[model samples]
Structures are given as C-alpha cells and as structure tokens.
Target: MKATRQLHDLGQSLWLDNITRTLLDDGTLARYIEEDSITGLTSNPSIFDAAISGGDAYDAGIHAKSLMGMQGEALFTELALEDLRRAADLFQPVFESTGHVDGWVSMEVSPLLAADTAGSIAAARHIHHKGRRDNLFVKIPGTPEGVPAIEEAIFLGIPINVTLLFSCAQYEAVSEAYMRGIERRLQAGLDPRVGSVASLFISRWDVASNKQLPDELHNKLGIAVGQQTYRAYRQMLASARWQKLADAGAMPQRLLWASTGTKDPDASDTLYISAFAAPETINTMPEKTLHAFADHGELHGVMDVDGGDADAVLARISAAGVDIDQLALTLQREGAEAFVKSWHHLLDGIAEKARQLAGKSDGAVLK
Candidate 1:
C-alpha cells in the first residue's frame, strides 16, 4: 500500500494543503482524494494569489464577474467560493462517510480582519453562508482577537480551522476557546457537534530557530514543538470538561499540522510528514509534500502521548539562548503580517486580472 494509506491506517489523516482552479477543474484534486487517500484540502490568501496570478485559469471567471459589474474583493470572494464549493462537493461523500470529521475544505476570512474580533466574526458568517457547503470551514487566526471570533463562529455552528498557531501555549488557548464554544452550544440547547482543528504550524519553528540555535539542534525545534503540543492536545481531550462535552455530542478539535513543507532544501522532503505522525491528528501538506510522501515516505512510529523527550529537547534549545515563549509571540506576529501580505497579493492579482481582461477586450496579453 502507498505510504499515504499507511498513515491513514496508522490513524493520522493526510490532508492536501492546496487548492486551485486547475486542480479542481482537471480532476486532479479528485484523484488525490481517491487514489492518494487525501481526505481534504485547505486554501489561504497566498495559495489563491498564486493560482490567479500565475496564469489564465481564472480569466473567464474574471470576465464573467466583471461583466456582471462585480469587482475587487467582492469579485474575488465569488471566484474563490466557486472553487471551494466544487472542492467541497468532491469531498461530500467523504464528509458524509466520516460523519463530518474529515473531508473539509477551509476558506479564510479576509486577513484584513486578522485583528478585528467583531469584523472577523461578521466576515466568517458571511463567508460561511456564501460557501453554502457543510464541508467548508472558515479559517480564523489564533490571534488574541481571533479567539473570541472563533468561539462566536463555533457557537453559531460554524466549523473552523484555527490558523497561525506557533506553540503549545497558543494551542492550549485555542483549544479552550473551542471548548467554550461547545459549552455555549450545550447551554443554548443546541447541538454540540461543532467541528474544529487547532492548526499548529511546523517547519516554521525550524526555519525561525535554525540560525539562532547551534547546529546540533538544527531542524529539531519544530518536531519538539509538535510533540509538546500533541501532548497537550491529548490531555485536553481526556479532560473531564472535554469528556462531558463529548458525551453531549461534541467532537474533540483535532490537532492539525500546518506549514508542514520543509523550508531548508538540506532537510528530508518528508520531514514534517513522517516526524509528526500521531493518531487522531491531521497533517495538511503542500501538494509537493503529499506527492513526496506518497512516493517515498515512511511511517516509522507515532508520536508519544507523554511527549517523550519534548521538554528535555526544548530545555536544551532554551539553554542555547533561544527563548521559546518569546519566539512564539514573534512568530505569530510575523505570520499574521505574512497573511496580510498574501491577502494584498491576492487582491492585487484579482485587480491585475480585471485590468488585463478589460485590456484584452480592448486587445492586449491575448488576441
């Protein structure tokens, strides 16, 4: 069997951390789901920006929407929804098959609202409604402000993908917020089946600390962070609060490994894929990583529930003068800024497409 399926049977979900019109239109996304055992996909401003800016895949839609008098972010959201809805449909069976635990496609709120709690909440609701697919998740950052919005979105029954997390502490806070949302649902006599995933970014830790730490600790920080977070996740799931919620139909917010692609070319291609393996967790990898894993990945063993040597490894790095807590805050700030940058790129790409298509109608870039 393919290593992708091996991971699945080993209890870790392999999710595709990419989506594009071409992937959906060419049946490539479907093939990943069917053949590689990929259960879901995720998209963000950067991914969409690259897809729309790279080629003419979105040309006809740009023209169609512009012809209907829509433009800018408004126009782009429609175009994005078009792709996500189709992707959601492709995963509908998996969604149904797994009772909604798997088979999710995530669409993020405008990065412009990354710090506005109320604004993020409003945008999430609008996008959730606009998506019109049960399998679609509205991604909210795990920022301080995004926490309340996450709870509100979940309280309102919105499935969420918590992005931009960098540490075990951050993951703990987001998990608490998830439980709060479920508690509110139970209080309001509503269903407690709201699904969520606390996305802890990997690879970034390695990239961030690589230059700061001694060579002995190279590429190990990310794995250690993941181990620590996974331990917290397991503890939270087994807590009495979570058990009570689970008895009332609530699902544990699965830990998702994001930013799984290796940044340094010197590292193993499947570094994140194979190293972070744990049951009841999700690994969302870029398409390249997914293909690499399918081709040559190995599932050595799953992560230890006790976090194994995570604390000792972290202590060693700390002694090397790298403060994990301080660095986590810095990384979160930088990651939010990166999202804002990507959002602008996505909108700029949309605007450029609008102008080019208009110029084409007037004759340019195409005859």
Candidate 2:
C-alpha cells in the first residue's frame, strides 16, 4: 500500500502543507483527497507568494478586487480567503465524516504581525470570521509574542494552526497555551471543543544542524527532534492535566510535523513522511514529499510514544558542539523573517497581477 494510505489507516492524518489555486482548479487537490488520503491542507505566506508570483492563477480575483480599490494586505487576504473557502468546501465531507478531527485547511495571518500579539489575535478573529468556514484554521506563529494570541484565538472559538515551532519545547509551550484557551472556554460555559494543531518544523532542524554534525548525523537532526516532540506530545496526552481537559470535552491539540520536505538532494524524499507517523498526530507534507510517499514510501511502524533513542541521538548532536536550543530560536526567527519576506512578495505579486488583468477579467487561469 502507499505510505500515505498507511499513515491514514494508522490514524495519523496526512495534511498537505500547501495550497494553490492551480491545485484546487486542476483537480490535483481532489485527487489527493480521493487517492492519497490527504485529509487537510495548510498554506503560509511563502506558499501563497510562490503561487501568486509564479503563475497567473489569481488574476481574476486580483482584477476584481483591484476594481474595488483593494490593495496590499487588504487585497491579498481577501483573495486568499476566496481560495480557502473553495478548498474548505472540498474537504467539508471529510470533516463531517471524522467529526471535525480531520479535513481542515489553514490560512495564516499576515506574517507582518508575527511580533504583534494583539494584532495577531484580532487578525485571526477577523480572518476566521471572513472565511466563515468551520474547517478553516488561522495559522499563527508559536513565537513568545504569539502564544497569547493563540490562547485568545482558541478561547474565542477560532481554530488555529500554531506554526513556526522548531523544537520540542516550543511544541509543548503551544500545547499548554492551547489548554489554557480551552480551559477558559470551559470556565465560561462555552463549548470546549476548539480545534487546533501545533506545527513542529522537521527539515529545518536538519538544515540548521547539518554543518555542525558528522556524516552519520547529517540528515538525522530533524527526525530526532520530531521523535522528542512526539514523546512530549504523548506524555501530555496521558497526563492528568490533559485528561482533565479531555474530560471537559476539550479536544487534544494535534502535534503536526511540518517542513517535511527533504533539503538534501541526496536524501530520500520520504525521509520526513515515513519516519514521523504517529497515531493522533499529524504530518503535513509538501506536494513533492506527498507524491513521493504515494509512489514508493515505507513505514516500519508508528513513532514510539516513549521516544526511543531520541535522547541519545540529540545528546550526540549536542556534544558535537551543536546548541540545539539556541539554534531552535534562531531558526524560528529566520522562519518568521522569511515568511514576512514572502508576505511582502505575495502582496507585490497580487498588485502586479491586478495591474495586468485590469480589463481582462473573463477567466480562471488555474482552471
């Protein structure tokens, strides 16, 4: 069986960590849902920036909005919502089938607001309202400043994808923040079943520690970090605190493996997909990795909840002069900055498309 199918059958949801108008219009996303077991999707500024700038897929939306005096973020967010709403419709059945545990599509708030907590909260709330889709998750960075936003967004009944986490500690912090938000809901006599996913970046760890490690340890950093985080995730799930939340009708905030694309050309493309499968967690892959898994991937078994060998491996990497904790901070900062760059590029791309499609609004390029 395809590894993607295997993961789904094992109860680990596989989400495509990408979305483009082309995918939706071309029926590629639909095929993934039917054939590859892709139950959800996620998009960031970088992905949106690439989709808009690298193609003419969004020309009509840009032209229509431009005629309405929208530009910059105001224009881009609306265009993104149009795409997300369509994507959400495609996955709504899966969502209903799974009782809201799967079949989600994520749209991020402006990376420009990563450091602004209140702005992030307000933006998340606004986007949640605009998208008006039950399956939509507002992507928020897991930065220190963004934690309060995550909690507030969750408490206010907004689904969230907690992105930009690069370490086990970061994942746990966001998990705790999620619980706090749910706790608030429970205390206020609200429905405590707010959906959320804490996204842990995988390949970036390997990329960050690659130069500092020996040959054997070159591509191992990402998976090791994932193992450690998965261990923490299991511990949290079975802990007394989490059980209390679960009893209160609060859902567990799934731990998602993100950035699963292999950075090293010589490495196997399925490295991240097959290595990190665990029940109840999620693994969101880029299209290349997802296709590779569907083509020829292997899964020995799901991740060991006890995190076998993760500590030894992480210790070895650390002893090799790789400060993993400090490095996590740096990688997250870089990720946030990169997203900001992509966000600006996305706005610029939309503006350019709006200019080009000023009078030629009779089309759907992605279709």
Candidate 3:
C-alpha cells in the first residue's frame, strides 16, 4: 500500500499544503485525491504568490476580474475562492464519510491584518461566508492578537484553521480559545460542533536551530517539539473539560502538523511526515513532500502519547542555550512577518499581471 494510504488507515489525515489554479485546471488535484490519499488541503499567501507569479494559469482570470473592477486583494480573493471552492467540492465525499472530522481545505485571511484582532475576525467571517462551502476553513494565525479573533470566529460558527503555532504552549492557548468558543455556544443554546484545527508548525524549528545544535541534535528539534505538543494534545483530549464539551456534542479541535516539508538538505525528505504520524491528527505537507512520502514513506507507528523522550530532548536543547519559549515567540513573529511580505508580493504580482494583460507597462514587475 502507498504510505499515504497507510497513514490514512492509521487515522492520520494526509493533506496537501498547497493549491494552485493550474493544479485544479489540469486535473492534478483530482488525481491526487483519487490516488494519493490526500484528504484535505491548505493554502497561504506564499503558496498563492508563487502560483500567481510562476505561471500564466491565473492570467485570464486576473484579466477578467480586473476588467470587472477587481484588482489587488479583491482580485486575489476571487481567484482563491474559485480554486478553494472546487477543492472543497472534491473533498466533500471524505468530509461526509468522516462525519465532518476530516477533508477540510483552509484559506487564510490577509496577513496584513495579523495583529488587528477585530479586522482578522471580520476577514475570517467574510472569507468563510464568501467561499460558501461547508468544508472551507478560514485560517487565522494563533498569534497573541489572533487568539481573540479565533475564539470569536469559532463562536460565530466559522470553521477555522488556527495557523502559525510553534510550541505546545502556543497550541494550548489556541486550544483553550477553541474550547471557550464552543462553551459559549453551548451556553447560548447553539450547536458546539464548529470544526477547527490548531496547526503546529514543525520543520521551521529545525531550520531555526540547525546551525546551533550539535551533530546529535541537528535535525531533532522539530520532531521533539512535535512530540511534546502531541502529548499535550492527547492529554487535553482526555481531560475532564474536553470530555464535558464532547458530551455536549462539541467536536475536538484537531491538531494539525504544518511546515512538514523538510528544509535541511541533509535530512530525509519524509522526516516530519513519518515521525509525526499520530492518529486523530492532520499532517499538511507541500506537494513535493507529499509525493515523496507517497512514493517511499514509512510509518513505524504513531507518536507516543507520553511523548517518549521529548522532555529529555528538549532539556538537552535548553542546556545547549536555546530558550524554547523565547524561540517560539520569535518564530511566531517572524512567520507572521514573512506572510505579510508574501501578501504584498502577491498583490504586487497581481497588479503587474493585470497591467501586462491590459497592454500597459509602467509598474515595476514583481520579482
């Protein structure tokens, strides 16, 4: 069996952390769903920026939208929704079969509003409503500012994929926000089964710590962090508070593994996917990583619920002078900033494309 099929059978959802108009129009996305066990998908500014700038797939759409008075973000959102709505429709079967527990595609709000809680909340709702798909999740970063937005969005029954989480503590904060939202809904006599996922980034940790670690710890930090966070997640699921909410028909916010693409050239390409294969969790990987895993991946077993040696590994990392908490905060901030840069690049690329399609050539090309 393909490794992706194995992982799916073991209860881990394998999601493609990418989306492009070409992938959809070319039937590649559909092929992946049929053959590769890809149950869900995710998209962000960086992915969209690459998709828009890398090819002419979106040119006709951009030209049409621009002609209709949409440019910049307005145009990008229209393009994105069209692609995501199609992906959502493709995954509708998995979604129904899983009882709404899997097969979700995520669309993030503008990263420019990362710190504006109110604005993030409004954007999330708007995007969710505009997409008009039941399985679409509007991604909101789990940054300090985004927590309230996440809670409010969930209370309003907007399915959310909480992105940009790093450590167990960050995941815990977002999980609490999800629960609070569900609790409020229950109190107000509303259904508490709002679907959500708390995405904890994996590979970036190793990328950030690679140069600082000794040979033994070179590519281990990310997995250790994942193990630690998964432990916390399992505990949370078993806790009395979650049990109470579950009894009230509130679905647990799943823990999604993001940034699973291998960044270190020396490491196994499928490192994150195989190591973090815990049931009831989602692993969203880039297309290259997904294909690599599907071709030759191996899953020895799911992650240890007790976290195995994660505590020991993290202790060694701390002894080596890396403050895990501080690093978590730094990574979150940097990730947000990186997305903001990508957002601008995407908008600039769209405008440049619109100009080119209209036979005007005055704006700077977005390279």
Among the numbered candidates, top TM-score falls to 1
- Tell me the spans in candidate 3 whose CA falls farther than 4 Å from its real position: 360-367
User: Clash pairs of candidate 2?
Assistant: none
Evaluated against the true structure, the overall lDDT of model 3 is 0.93
Please report the candidate that would top lDDT against the real structure.
3
Task: State each model's CA lDDT, in order.
Answer: 0.91, 0.90, 0.93
Which digits, one per residue and each the tens of the lDDT, describe model 2 over residues 1-367? 7778888999999989888999989899999999999999999998888888887788777877888999998898888899899999999999999889999999999898989999999999899989989999999999999999999999999999999999999998899899999999999999999999999998988887888899999998888888999999999999999999999888889999999999998899888887887899888998988888899999977789999799999999999999999999999999999998888777877777887686455445444
Over 1-367, each residue of candidate 1 has an lDDT whose tens digit, in order, gives 9999988988788889888899988989989988999998888988998888888999999988998999888998999999999999999998898889998999999988989999999999999999999999999999999999999999999999999999999999999999999999999999999889989999988998999888889998999999999999999988998899999899889999999999989889999998988889999999999999999998878899999899999999999989999999999999899989988888888877888788889775465
Top-down lDDT ranking: 3, 1, 2
Off by over 4 Å in 2: 359-367
Instruction: Give every collision pair in model 1.
Output: none
The C-alpha TM-scores of every prediction are: 0.98, 0.96, 0.97
Model 1 residue runs over 4 Å out of place are 363-367
Summarize candidate 3's per-residue lDDT along 1-367 as a digit string, tens digits. 9999999889889899999988998899999999999999999999999998999999889988988999878889999999999999999999999999998999999998889999999999889889999999999999999999999999999999999999999999999999999999999999999999999999999989978889889878889999999999999999999999999899999999999999988989999998998899999999999889988999878899999899999999989988889999999999999999999989999998898887742343442
